[model samples]
Target: MFDDTFCLNVRFLLNTQFKMIELPDNIAALQSYKPGKAVEDIFEGKNFDRTAILSSNENNLGTSPKAVAAIQEAATNSYLYPDPSGMKLRQKLAAKHNTTIDKIIIGNGSDGILSNIFKAFFRPGDELVSSAGSFVAVNVMTKLNNIPYKQAPLTKEYAFDLEAILDLVGPRTKAVYLCNPNNPTGAMISNRALKAFIEKIPEHILIIVDEAYAEFAASLSSEFPDATQIELPNVITLRTFSKAFGLAGVRLGYGVGSQFIVDTLMKVKLTFNPSIIAQAAGGAALDDAAFMQETIEMNKKGLAYYYKNFSQMQLNYVPSFGNFVMLDMSTEERAMYVFNQLLNRGVFVRPLAFFQLPHCLRITVGLPEECQLLVEKMAEVMTLEKN
Candidate 1:
């Protein structure tokens, strides 16, 4: 019984209003974070071993036995809201780092800390500086906030170009971000270099040292910088439980900084972050020293294994301080070829295109047998590619 002309006019007016709703440029420009291909997406129900997922640099050995118990115990308390301040976890972190509780800030993960970092310190005109191929989260955060940046290229050896980054610092540079033992590439800045870099940074500008892989580097090398020891008012060191602690599932991380920065971040951070389960897991995991030591040793051995095998194969790779090694397959085409080939054989390794290293692939160290399986399958892919 509705009139066709009336319905058409109403529809036309509605469509016009919907079409006029434009997204802000900053939001519109964002490229969604697309991580490496998932095993399920690649296989699509094909019969394959599900355990060969080495793409994300996740735990090779299992979660800590103690943390597992803690997680179960905490789950039963799901009816309760988490402590809004996350004081308990922050207290443990403070004690471990020889800092007061006021100096630590907990988050859902280091990424959460980063989100707060931008919110607390950055302004419209502030320019952040870092290397081009560092963590992509910086890209997303900066662009989302409409913040401009200055970028230096990584050194030929695939390390942060400290001097170049320092050179980029100027009046407009309000912050500098460094990812030590950087993602995908896995090279670390030495303690001496880090010190020199920090000393030169103007006190007015903040320095964010993202040590997501610090545990692995410290275990393997004597000279790795302990950013926590710097004690500079402008310096904030970020770390996570996800990597070396094997609690990636729980998503707990924190930042160590001056009381002022900590207080500022707390104001911006979400209240009740890192729910009850995460806090319990992190606290219990910290007590399991044996488990952490075993993880560090395994990562050390795994990196060495990768170095020896990659050398034997005559493949060019960056020496990695982190758990994963980056392979330069010489071209993006070849990297994609090997990546697809590995997936077909039930192996999933990371292709670094999104990390701006299109010709490179990052392979995490698996168990000894899984490592062997990958090498064997890689050899097959190499032969097939040659043909």
Candidate 2:
């Protein structure tokens, strides 16, 4: 409708308006979470056939056979939108948890569901409490939602400091986030401690128990607490098929809570998430008991190997209940040196500095060959460091 001069003027005005729109203060202050590097990323400069990505705590055994099959079948129906409610997957999850479907909440992943929880439930002046070095995602989520996050230091054993956390729970606190078999450290609170902590929390405070690695922890430790089994109306138990189920690529996770809480979360959740293939994969993965057992057995063996190798090398390491272990490198500088050396050797691991653990690094338990490679590379690096 206008000539070239008018068009140029309009373009300049639009650009100026767009530039003036700034991110919210909270989001502006956020530091992006650093994820594990891909095999390609680590080996980009150098060409090497051997590579092990023990970074993201993914299952090294590949995708679940049952889930792979389901994914393939679902791909044929990709033209249709995913079920808004994710009914079939919810039904399966509810059955597994021995709860009704209304109590179940599914999302793109446990992290996705966690973000939705913040949006739906968290409000200004609402403080969230947790352990200091627990999960970095919680740190990100709190800032993302502008929720006031308070934390107590971890216990000497690296488990959640229940007493300290409870002491920090003030009248302004609305929720507590606990990551059992916590990420990076893989430390878990015993069943008794978990129960005691829950009882101490005020009834109005929502306790979120994120058991992402619960299946592995339960398999490895008799003392592991399954929070979903507690059946508390105020407690929300979140689990994911991403880890032990070997469905990380599919990104399926769920939460078990009261029906009212589920409804509230549903209102904020994306209408169509965890697409058709993901939902189908999740449903099938639940039935793959043999695969789960294999994952656990492999994880057990891999962890033992890492512990033994680390011990022989005189490196301090945390005994893990999950599929990964944390190695204390004595200082942030040492940790970064180890990380860079491993990266050069085509072995990618995660640095825990951002997890408030600057002196440690996390390594996922890979397959037998991969584990051996990691040990060999670590030995070489440490030997060189000493020299």
Candidate 3:
């Protein structure tokens, strides 16, 4: 009996190797999107004398004074839960846009709202359609839900090829995604083009237009699409406080759509989708139109500063409507090398490999001095490369 027991134990021990199972198929198969490197990560073993992070396309103008004051006033009430309905902020948003409160639905960020939308609308066999080289989060969310995704290639000028995207849609297509003044490239769809495109799409398939960078574009051009113009039942427009409002850390974003779409999103959104502090800050930011205008003016000046430097360096870049611009590197390796060099120097700019444009880097428009410093550092790097 002892011998038999020993043999059984040995067999059980040996079986450990065979019992190692494969990882779950869902998350394992999904592509992970690389976000901007945190400022803390650049410190290494010792703190740098000067460090600035412009990688994430964040508002360079610091958070609004009014919003900061609002946060301070609300600090004592942190123990209490935020209102789940977000009624106050929704009402304010509606008043600003000349719409009803029920038409707005707030979320943790636009990304959260998007994920919830995918979960609420998509099924295992449904197909997701989006422009190639757009935001990586959309692709990740689609795969997480086991939805098949189809990429509609952009035009040579990096504009949304609406016709190409429409051609890809069929019975299985559930949603279409767009990042107007699109990330990395900063190309935008004209208002007329977008309106015509939406008119062609069926009511059942959703058209998600991400206007995260819309405020910056609003100041620069009037040709971009506005939510008020899109009256289609299929259209949903997204905006965020993380951009022009200088509240990236606060995580406030909202979706404006038909009442049916807003209701559908609320069904999947968590209780207290936005924190009280975030709501307060967002509302205050909206009230501070002067701050927003100053930010817009600074961005325009900074953009010009960078373009002048680009001209002198003879570096090619995509003309931008957003707060950032993409410079093309002859090879992906060179772009990555410049990214690493800048990070070591305590300036962080984003590499574009995550967005599938491996030979480019996206640099946010910072303060005038910051822009000058970035140009000086880039010039130094380029000179070194030639030697």
Candidate whose lDDT is highest:
2
| Candidate numbers, best lDDT first, in rank order | 2, 1, 3
By summed lDDT, the worst window of 10 consecutive residues in model 2 runs over 13-22
TM-score of 3: 0.91
Error of 1 at 247 (Å): 1.3
TM-scores for candidates 1 onward, in order = 0.93, 0.94, 0.91
CA lDDT scores, all candidates in order: 0.88, 0.90, 0.85
lDDT of 2 at 169: 92
Clashes of each: 0, 0, 0
lDDT tens digits, residues 282-318, model 3? Answer: 8898999889998999999988888898988888888
Query: Global lDDT for candidate 3?
Result: 0.85
- Runs in model 3 lying further than 4 Å from the true structure: 1-23, 31-37, 44-49
Candidate 1 Cα errors over 4 Å, as ranges:
1-9, 12-17, 33-44, 49-51
Which of the two, 1 or 3, has more lDDT?
A: 1
TM-score of 1: 0.93
Candidate 1 structure quality by residue, lDDT tens digits, 8-105: 78889888543467889999888776797555476667787543778888777879999999999999998999998888888899999998998898
